[model samples]
Target: AALIVCVLVLELIVRQFPAFVIELTVWGLHKEIENKEVNVADKEAEAKHQQHLARFCRK
Candidate 1:
């Protein structure tokens, strides 16, 4: 009975393993996309500042 119980537990874990992996993968992708968005925003701000500096120098 102990062996059967162990086997059942193992089987359950194996079944759920794929779902766990998928969740991790989704989380990682979400973080990556968020980082990309932040990077883009930073670049845009930098560009705006550069434009402002250019206008200032034109005076």
Candidate 2:
């Protein structure tokens, strides 16, 4: 009986593990995308500033 219970519990954990891993992966991807967007925005702002500096220097 104990062995049967152990097997059932193991099977349950095995079934759940993949879903847990997938959730973690998706969550990580979302965070990475958010960070990438922030970095892109910062780069755009930096480029604009550089353009302004260039225009000022030309005058």
Candidate 3:
């Protein structure tokens, strides 16, 4: 009886482990996407500022 209970618990954990890993992977991907968006926004702002400066210099 004890052995059966232990096996059941191990099987439950094994089934749930993949779900946990998938959730963790999705969370990590979300963070990576957010960081990339911030970096892209910063680069765009810098490019716009450089263009403005160039126009001013031309005038």
Give me the candidate number with maximum TM-score: 1
For model 3, the local distance difference test gives: 0.95
Task: Specify the poorest-scoring 10-residue window by lDDT in model 3.
Answer: 12-21
**What lDDT tens digits, residue by residue, belong to model 3 across residues 1-59?**
99999999999878998997898899999999999999999999999999999999999
lDDT tens per residue, model 1, 1-49: 9999999999987899999789999999999999999999999999999
Q: Which candidate order results from sorting by lDDT in descending order? A: 1, 2, 3
C-alpha RMSD between model 1 and the true structure: 6.4
Per residue, candidate 2 scores C-alpha lDDT tens digits across 1-59 of 99999999998878998997898899999999999999999999999999999999999
RMSD of each: 6.4, 7.0, 7.6
- Evaluate all candidate structures by whole-model CA lDDT and list the values in order: 0.96, 0.96, 0.95
Count clashing pairs, candidate 2: 0
| Candidate 2 global TM-score | 0.53
